[model samples]
Target: MKLALILNVIDPKIGGVMIMGDRGTGKSTTIRAIADLLPKIEVVEDDVFNSHISDYELMGESIKEKIDKGQNINSILIKVPMIDLPLGATEDRVCGTIDIEKALTEGIKTFEPGLLAKANRGILYVDEVNLLDDHLVDILLDSAASGWNTVEREGISIRHPARFVLVGSGNPEEGELRPQLLDRFGMHAEIRTVKQPSLRVQIVEQRSKFDSNPYECLNEFEAEQEKLKRSIIEAQSILSNVSIDYDLRVKISEVCGELDVDGLRGDIVTNRAAKAFAAYNSKDQVEISDIKQVIALCLRHRLRKDPLETIDSGFKVKKVFENIFGSS
Candidate 1:
């Protein structure tokens, strides 16, 4: 799950990660901790949407207008937004609402930005996402894909930049997202509660240390955090230069085809993920080891459900991968 999250941070275009694990597995804690690993982003000064200074597609309407008018745009570094999407949130809360009264009285559309706006160019995390309304889930996925959110009230329509890495976490026991919806996520990571007694004890000890001396604990990890932050920033800089072999690409697609995965999403994600993984490792060329590492994460949830099959989806993907590309 940590690897998947880091990869998404390196390239939000890899889409977002869906994490499924047992309750009390530190899903939320880990997701929040990743924010610390992220480097600060550049945004237009005083922009509510965290609009980029130069990327027009990522800028809000007001910022775009200012740029068009040859206005001096100021930028500042800020932490990437990490938004928690509550289960009971209404559509208006997730997508900004238009003030109908103002629209009618003043003949102007007054738009109030919502969570999506706040999450632009950052992370939007949904806990127990399977329990969220399907329509809201659709809206989130659509905005994540298109990088824009459109809210129409009466005859007034307002759209804004809504690019964000959409991360969702849930326990399989509660419920599961519809297969179609699950497939839309770029990667899926499954984690389990620690089974080793020593590991469990160490986890408890770590938690106790943090709770008792939060400052000390943070200071202890500060160097490590900065190192990881530097690595992520460097990876992002060289991601486009990372290349995957054509044979590997064909083999990745072949694995997807053999697994009966729907659509070309699995193939595309695997390719992108492999490239990201390579870049993360500071390698310019993708190796079979890289593909082997991320193939299952990218394709596991995309496989067709077979009720009678007892094998794990990830294991099935690896088995197919080994057959096609030979054992790593």
Candidate 2:
């Protein structure tokens, strides 16, 4: 559900999500499924940086050289990035680095772009994120915030657009991530194993059918898939028309202040999430109901420590939201 809301906000300006869940909860599967359902985007065929097909004329000379050589300049619709960043991945693997082979063989000063380059304008999904290196996390955060990737090595400097939504997943029982990195995410969600008998049965049955006859199962769900795709496209089409009422802005700030959230991120993220929610609902204007629906998703992880005993920050967000906006 939270993923659907986040998908509706997949502009270059919006941040990504963090999902914490237990094993066997199908975290990876759900991410893959949602990604599979996303509509293909047009990109320059055979381009390493994955530049949009529509933006080819503005591309750098290096990319344009391939086109100039008659290297098949047709635009192709390809699936967006759904990269999985596993543990033990090195910095050179995640960020661009000196192209050793080119330097050694041709005496050419060149760069080898890495996963981050491939993930430009796409989703960089990280599983077991708690175990990842902090420096890598910082690289991701920097690129996301600045919408560019900068790398310098072996007397060569490179910078390219690296806008992406970082979808990070981890099991909290194994370890914890630093607060600074966690706060960078736009939204957070928690998932667990299904406890209800009927729900569990339904889930298992669906998986079994998919496993047994994948094509048939996909055919059966084709209508639903197209529906979801249309909704996302529709949401994107209307997102530019959504606006925030001034009073609602005050209410958002009030709730964040009441919770004693760390920085203005809580306020900013809530505002963005509300706008996306309104867009998803086909509303040109944001309403308090939109904010109310998404406040918890935006601020759940941004809350300060509670003076009281253990309590979910989401619950606290709901309480503060109702108190400020009057549960309308």
Candidate 3:
């Protein structure tokens, strides 16, 4: 799960990760903690949408207007916005509504930016996502794909940058998302509660220590966190230069085809994830080990399920990968 999060941060083009696990598994805690490790992003000053200062395509209409009028745009560095989307949120709340009162009184079209606006260029986390309304889920996936959200109401149309890594977690016991929707996520991480008593005790003790003295615990991990942050930033800088072998690419697709995956998304995400893993390890060339590490995470959830088949999806991916690439 941590690997998936790190890879997505390195290359948001890899899409985002879906985490499914049992209750009380700390999925939410881990996802939120990752925000702390990330480097701050630069945004146009006081811009609600976290618009990039120079990238016209990433800017909201207000920021673009400033650029068009040759106004000096002020910028500030801020932590990447991490917005939590609640289950009961309405369409207006998730996708910003037209400020009806402001529009009528001032005779101007104004948008009340919602969660999507705040989530631009950042992470949007939805806990219990499987229970979330399917309509809202569709809206989020659409925006994440298009990198923009359009809100049209009462003859007024508003569009803004909504690019964000969409991370979601759910308990499978409660329910499961439709296969079609689940396949949209770049990778799926399935976690289980620790079965061994010793490990469980250790985990409990660690949490207890943190609860007893949060500051002291944080201080202990500060150096390690900073080291990881530096690695992630460096990986991002060198990701474009990372190269995957041609044979490896063909084999990655072959594995996907052999699994009878529904679409090419599985193949594409696997390639990007392998490269991201190579970059994460500070290697310019992707190795078989890198692909081996990420291929299952990228393709497991994409496989077409057979009611009669007993094989695990992840195991099947590995088996195919081994067949195509040969055990190295």
Candidate 4:
């Protein structure tokens, strides 16, 4: 819920939450629930790219048809495409290549879209992100940053808007993500296995009940999910009006500078996230408490490593905020 709220505030269009944690911590379960809880997005029919919002890239022939006939464009609400980037996927499969079947049968240079295109305007999930090939990882990072995909290999030179929230999950113990890729994640969270026996038992029982009677279980949670979704929609509506005072902005910059966080992205994302939180709570402006709650998620992964000892990064971040801006 916190991650979703943050995303809605930060970058409702392309912001994403990358979850890092150990296995069996309900990472995938939580992602699926969030996807289910979101309102449906409309898309063009049978377009794997979910290309409906813009018509800039449509084929010349189709564009002419729509222009000449003056046909009313129809939009259909489908489940937001939550595409999973599987491990062991090849570059050809991910960024797409020429259509082998088309070339052999029709003798044409038809460009086939890949997973990235299919994930446009939606969430692209990469489980075991740390294990992804370096080349594939580069492609993902480039697409996420630029919001566009250009494939020049295999006699194809197609460019399409490939904007989407990139969500990745991995156990940090297994492998580490490259610093370049790490910076692309707007918010990061670590989930741990529930230690309390009763809580663990409750989780298992809930899963069993969900599996046994999926429909009934979903029905029971449907009202709660709907209320949550309404909250998100309401938050989005008010996000534009939320104010960030100049004093708070200076404090945000100072804290990031104090922590030695690289670049200005941290400052920008932090300010935007705080305003989003304020809007979520129907406040006219952000408060110090909002910054404190948001700074941990924004700056935790951006801090420079200290060799002397282990650091409680979250606590350290909160402490910095408290010292600079006073506790909320």
After TM-score superposition, what is the CA distance of residue 328 in candidate 1 from its true location, in Å?
A: 2.1
State the C-alpha lDDT per candidate: 0.93, 0.79, 0.93, 0.76
Taking the tens digit of each residue's C-alpha lDDT, what string does model 2 give over 1-328? Answer: 4553355344445578888988889777777666665678877777667786546532534666676786756767889777777788898888878886787799887877888888876778888888899999888888877777878876667777776778788998988688888888888888878889999999999999999999999899899888877877788888888899999999999998998888888798888888877887889889988898888888887876555859887888899899999978
lDDT at 306, model 4: 78
Q: Where does candidate 4 stray beyond 4 Å? A: 1-10, 53-72, 100-109
lDDT of 4 by residue, 170-206 (tens): 8989977877677777777777778999998998999
Residue 101, candidate 3: alpha-carbon lDDT: 77
TM-score for model 3? 0.97
Residue 32 of model 1, lDDT score: 86
Model 1: residue 130 alpha-carbon error in angstroms: 0.5
Candidate 4, pairs of clashing residues:
none
> What TM-score does candidate 1 get on C-alpha atoms?
0.98
Model 1 Cα lDDT, one tens digit per residue, 1-328: 9999999999998889999999999999999888888888899998878999898899899999898999999999998899999999999999989999999999987898999999999899999999999999999999998899999989889889999999999999999999999998999999999999999999999999999999999999999989999999999999999998898899998999999998999999999999999999999999999999999999999988888999999999999999999986
Model 2 misplaced stretches (Cα beyond 4 Å)? 1-5, 56-61, 64-73, 100-107, 306-308
Q: TM-score per candidate, in order?
A: 0.98, 0.91, 0.97, 0.88
Q: Indicate the worst ten consecutive residues by lDDT in candidate 3.
A: 99-108
In terms of TM-score, how similar is model 2 to the real structure?
A: 0.91
**CA shift of 170, model 2, Å:** 0.7
**Candidate 2 vs candidate 4: which has greater lDDT?**
2
Best by lDDT: 1
